[model samples]
Target: MSLKSERRGIHVDQSELLCKKGCGYYGNSAWQGYCSKCWREEYQKARQKQIQEDWELAERLQREEEAAAYGSTAQAPPGAQPLTFSKFEEKKTNEKSRKVTTVKKFFGASRPGAKKVLGGKRRGDAPEAKSGSPSISRQVSLETDRVSKDFVEFLKPFQKPGQDLYKQCKIFLEHMHHKRELSIEEQSEYAQDFYQSVAEKLQTRWKVSPEKVEKAMDQVEKYVMTRLYKYVFCPETTEDEKKDLAVQRRIRALHWVTPQMLCVPVNEEIPEVSDVVVKAITDIIEMDSKRVPREKLCCVTSCSKHIFTAIRTSKEEPASADDFLPTLIYIVLKGNPPRLQSNLQYITRFCNPSRLMSGEDGYYFTNLCCAVAFIEKLDAQSLNLSQEEFDRYMSGQSGPSSSTSSSSLLPRGRESSCPEGSALALVRHNLEAVGQLSRRQERVEREARRLERDLIEWTEGLGREVRGLVQRCPLRLHPGTPASGTPAAPAVAIDSDNLEDPRLPPPLQPQVYAG
Candidate 1:
């Protein structure tokens, strides 16, 4: 059975997934739901419109500045007529008429005798006069322009070699552009060969060192690829886009797969772990936004770092490939990044071979590809679930059992049916509850300690007060002993004499009553 047939009942809105332009191509969120071609067209049109508006604005501002300056320096010429609104309007109209006439003459120069009438020289044939103000083209800005300028400055001393290199690259690009028969692979091979030849020339012909040659090659790649991105990336001749759509559909269908199912140790309940996981997801999704292979590779590395951080946060140990790969797969499933296949293919086909063959970027990119592959071929055995269970989940008849606890975490009336949502809700709710309980426990312990301290302080104070009172008025063990440190006098022999003086009548009365 086909893979599509196995993933039955996984429904996605066709309109939502397809290009908004109705071009029968898959859409990407990075392009605002348009295919790459449509996106590029829209972007160019918008940019052109913006440039026109900016030019008009700048012209208006310059005119206003000039007018203000003239007004500030107000002093009519000695013989000049007094200016009036009517005269100003008439003068403006006359100037506009003169401009119209000039334009007509310039355009009509193609006609016979028109050039002779305009001094026998076409405007195109004459050298353009340098102006104090910058040209419209110069006013237009691009990020790559700065890089190009820096490169030019770097090549200033080697003008001949630079021009040769530029001419070669331009010719090569033009040839590739016109040669419609060349396949994408053949074009890529040609590009690679050209790059290698250029590097050799920089070293052998120009005597550039190997280290500088690498930098120069980087600049060259950037210059070439920037111009060729639209042509080379997801070209109509390739099935990379179709593979992208397939992977997207598959990932959407498998949205129910959870960390538990994948054995990915991502505990979103921990704040640190959750943040790292989110960063990783963001990095993966942002890969589509970058146009360069190096930039996309950097995104992969960033995502890998985040994944490792998440694993460390959850497991409290160093993460290995065994831990890293499953987590990456889980991240991919969660992120469902747009144009996954096309981006990977672009990087593989065009990225500097040396950069991809070695280094941390290469390793992370390979793991990412493996993760994507694992996801594409995922089945019951891959997830360690029974075939019947997998089918039920795929058909939307069942969800992962691990998500059941997540239901209780949802709000009373606002439960999510999506397994991923349920799982995240569970983590968020459990984390909040744990945090609350932890705070309460801490408060209780704090209050207990405070009460214990107060009791100890009160007991100590009471003991001190009692000791002070004892010291101030010492208790006499015997009536003969004094509080002062003095020797006790001899005890009196007739204690009855002292007692009988006050109690003699009482004793006689008690004896008569007892008898």
Candidate 2:
């Protein structure tokens, strides 16, 4: 045959072609086994299928493991994890441990010219450092169960980082939230909101004075500077931390306004709370307050002695300190600049006590106490006064009181127009009386002074008995040595004097349940 025809006609052996003993091939039955290439292809496909199946199985197993592990613990049982974030932490003990802690590891940070983590975090993902503000943000705290915005801000310096740093941070913080030392360059960490809030809580509840409230704020500041900064802690904590504990103290500083403005609601249990709390909510429902013109009303020297007094508080024992927010947000949302009374009221309530104010606060004639007193005195004089007197001295009709220019924005007052010589003379007289009494009382021991209050109480009792006995007879209490009491004992009576009573008697409701 020709060479090409011979090559084409050449045939291979069947056993050689099949190659069954060493390899596995599905269709090649000659060897009764398989070929190496066929076996490799089948093995690869089966391995891939098995891998996919294993992946599904592992995912299912992981879910089950999480369920079993978390069923009995509050460590967020799988699906319930995110729900925990939305729930209120009634008690701090119930909070879960965070997954990662801050540590003082030297990331390429301290190379001398190190900037704050200002550029390493992505803007979309991480919290931005608060810049562009040369003035400090105010801080205020409401209660034990709350965190003021100030506290959150205080945590900022420790948190601010650039995008790249933040992503690395989230990873570095992985599964080990224990404790971390942050490197803040001793910037201002004073929680302005927290301080203001604390002052408000104290003012409305205990009717503490602004100066005393400031003292409390100072106490709280010391606690934060010394204690909170000293160690790493859970984000949520009890009222026991020095800062927290000090702030939690119940005494409230208040405005020299009406009790309704500050002391109106006693506790949540008091049904009046719903009435008071419901007013704001219902006002939104009931009457739509219109945004009236920004009338140029003459400036008034209205103010509050403390933040809480400025807020219209509910009577609930644990007063809802957030009362100021809803009303404020409402006014802002409505695009209506609130009236001076409303504006000053909310502003005084919201402002951090330590941030903007100093010294004795001025009172509006509308101050419930002053109004009541004015009314009683008016009634005592006659059945009624002319509308001019009512508008000039009673209610909130007057532009401002003589004592007002001494408070808030303006400090200059024309020292004239007191019944005796000038308003300053009157103020000086009252202040002098109070100052001498204060000095004399402060000279005694606390316990002895307390006994003196009891003595005053006894005298009050004796006087009451005498008055009752002589109600029908022409008898009276002789003005002899005035009964003395502890510095704090008269606080309640002093508060009682501030109520806005429509009748002739001084309103007797105690401002503070206990000093």
CA lDDT, every prediction?
0.68, 0.33
Best by TM-score: 1
* CA lDDT, candidate 2, residue 239: 14
lDDT of 1 by residue, 1-515 (tens): 11121122121233444567887655444345554456556755765666676566556655755685477457766575544546555555565545423222321222222113254432222332432234532542253577567667766766888888877878887877764345555576567668768988998998888887777777677766765665678866566777899999999999888765666766788898888889999999999987667778889999999999998888898876667777888899999999998998788667665455455775677667656766777888777678999999999997777454354345665565435566676777778889999999999999999999999999999999999976754544446677897988765443334344552343222123454
Candidate 1 TM-score, C-alpha based: 0.54
The Cα RMSD of model 2 versus the native structure comes to 37.7
| Candidate 1: residue 106 lDDT (0-100) | 25
Report model 2's TM-score to 2 decimal places.
Answer: 0.14
Instruction: Give the distance in Å from residue 157's predicted Cα in candidate 2 to where it truly belongs.
Output: 29
Off by over 4 Å in 2: 1-166, 171-179, 182-240, 252-258, 261-515
* Per-candidate total of colliding backbone pairs: 0, 53
Tell me the lDDT of model 2 at 458.
97
Candidate 1 residue 311 C-alpha distance from true site, Å: 1.7
Model 2: per-residue lDDT, tens digit, 399-441? 3344432332122352443445446565666687789899878
